[model samples]
Structure formats: C-alpha cells, structure tokens
Target: MNDAFGKRVRRLRLDRDWSQQELSLRSGISTPHISSIERGKRFPSLEYAKRIADALGVALVALCDDASELRSPKMRGSAEELPLYLQNFVLNEEATPYLEVAHQMSQLPKEDADLLSLVIGLLVKRRYETPVLTP
Candidate 1:
C-alpha cells in the first residue's frame, strides 16, 4: 500500500510541477510529514488523505491502492472513449443486480421472489432481440 501510494503521489506532484514543500504547504500537511508519506514510511489518516488529494486534484482513493476500492479488478485507459454509466456498470456488475433486486424485493413477501426474477428476465430479453424466422 505504501509503495503504490507513495509512487502515485510523487508522480502526481511531479506532473503538477510541485515540490514536496510546495505540496505540503498547499495541502496543510507539514513538509516532514509529506516527506515521510512520499517515502513510503508512513500512512495518512482519512482526513489527511483527503487534504492531500484535494491539493493534488485527485480522488482520495488514488492515494490508496488497496483492493477494496481502488485496486480490485482494475480497468485502464481514458474515460472519454466510453460513457461513464457503461464504465461503472462494467466495473461493478457483480453487485448491481443483487442490490437492485434486494431493494425492490423488500416490499414483497416470500412468494414474490419472482418479482425481481421477472424484471431481470425482461431486461435480458430486451437486450438481445432475435428476429423470428418463419418457413
């Protein structure tokens, strides 16, 4: 985590033409602390991470390469090529159906599991329309 985060921060800072002292001053994180963090010797708390990210104009999670949010099943390349909704759907497909069905199914009783099932069935059908062939 430290190695990846430090490298990311260093890369971003250099990209912005900012030195460690300048970044520290802008982020309100002391120069010594910034040096420590950039050297992979220390980890910042959530608040500090946010401050640094804001200063660098990057997402807070960019400073952390941990698997839960940033690093898991990673995707690459520019976002301009694809739509944001499609990118998010492709990245989080595993959890989408479960969450959607759970929320919608909560109002129904045991017999209505089929309610969510029917919705999904229709979605699948609509997505792949096949023409009828008559002989």
Candidate 2:
C-alpha cells in the first residue's frame, strides 16, 4: 500500500486509542501484519483491507478513497442519500449510534439494504414512496 494509506490506517487505529496488538485481535490479523500495514511495508489484499476497515468501525470505502464507486447497485438511492441526510440532520443523543451503521450501509446486501433503507427513511421521518426492485 502507499504511505498515505498507511498513515490513514495508523490515524484510524490511534483515533480509537488502540494498540497494534489490540487491532490485530479485533481484526484477526497478526500484530506483525498490522505493524507492517501501518508502516507501509506491505500491501494487503482486499480481504485484509476489509478486516481492517471493519475493526475500525468504518466502511471499506472509508479506507479507500478511490473506491467510492464500489458499492453494490442495489438500493443506490439510499446509499446516495445517507451522506446528504447525515450532513443536514440535526443532532440528537439517540441518533449518534445509528450514524455509524448508516455509514456502513454501502456494503449491505440487497435484502439488508431494503431493511436499512426502510429504517433510515423512518428515522429521517421523511415521506417518500419506496422504490420497487427488479431482480
């Protein structure tokens, strides 16, 4: 991986106040591997990258700026709407936790995407007809 991505990994790890060993345990990756990734000594495969992202409580896209378009086509509208709603919605104590899950909606499968979209639509208290899906 490039040094910039390594820096991003290190920053995210540090943001959670987690040591490399801690990250390794959560990620199911070895501490040495985690160290290598953080130091830009290795380029991890997508699987490893995904482990790192999930452990960081961030979506895979968060780790890969260039991969923003990697999302599944199912529920594209909801995936696109998440950022807008998050940007404009007023803050409340209860809404904080859901924000993280919403960020992860990009990776959800079609069935889960439908469920989450319903929940998010309700959470936003918006009035909109649901989109029909074609297999």
Candidate 3:
C-alpha cells in the first residue's frame, strides 16, 4: 500500500467532514477496511479507489496522487502554504481547464483571472454534459 495514497484518501475524507465510518458507508467499504486503508495497513484496488473517489465527489486521480505534481509551476506552491480545501479543489479533474485558463489569463489581474476561469470552467462543464438536440 502506498502510504502517500492512503494519506491522500484520509485527507480528502476529512476535508468533507467525513469520519472513517461515514466514508465506509458512503463508499460501500467496511469501516475496518477504510481504517486499514487510511492507516496504510492496506492498499486500495483501483475499483475500491474509484468507489471512494465517487463517494467523495472527486476524480480518482486526486486520491491516487498529488495533483500539484501535475500542475504548472504557477500552481505548484509549497503544499504547506496552500489551504487543504483549495488544494483539493484545484486538483479535481473538472478544474483542469479552469486552471489552464487561469494560467493563460495570468496577464490579467489575479481577481479577474480567477473569475474568468471559474466562468469558463462552468461553461465547459455544462457544454460537455448538455445533450445536443437533433434538428
């Protein structure tokens, strides 16, 4: 079991105000198993990871690895310097385009860039999920 992976899971769970039992209930995993995973006594299979990620409303990648590792330099602040919530939020797969757009919009003021990125992210998510009507 990757200790780092387990830590990530525990962190995400806590961020959602979930206890191990709560996470187990939500993910359909047992409390003991969840405890083992969080303690790094056991590793989660891909399927189990997917279940947990789904229950946590996060992308599987967010639990398996540090999203900051994949982020652009501008996004990679010292982990200690960033809030856990913001770190988790930025790491979500759905936030990728928003982060990228924010990077491109860096020339703009920080507040403007952030707002624009959020708008773009919402539009992108909606466009992808919205069904096209036939003519």
Sort by TM-score, best first: what order?
A: 2, 3, 1
| Worst lDDT 10-window in candidate 2 | 70-79
Listed per candidate, the RMSD to the true structure in angstroms reads 12.9, 11.8, 11.8
The lDDT values for all models are: 0.69, 0.70, 0.72
Estimate TM-scores for all models. 0.47, 0.52, 0.50
Cα lDDT of model 2 by residue, 50-111, tens digit: 99887776666667775443322232222345677654552556776676666567466669
Output the lDDT of residue 128, model 3: 92
Ranked by lDDT, top first: 3, 2, 1
Position 43, candidate 3: lDDT: 89
Greater-TM-score candidate between 1 and 2: 2
Give me the overall lDDT of model 3. 0.72
- Candidate 3 Cα errors over 4 Å, as ranges: 67-135
Please give the range of 10 consecutive residues that has the lowest summed lDDT in model 1: 68-77
Our tally of clashes for model 1 stands at: 0
Question: lDDT tens digits, residues 1-135, model 1?
Answer: 466777778777877667898888878999998888888898888888888876665556666755523221112233345788866764686967865555445434446768667877998898679666779
- Candidate 2, which segments miss by more than 4 Å at Cα? 66-103, 106-135
**1 versus 3: better TM-score goes to:** 3
Please give me the total number of clashing residue pairs in predicted model 3: 0
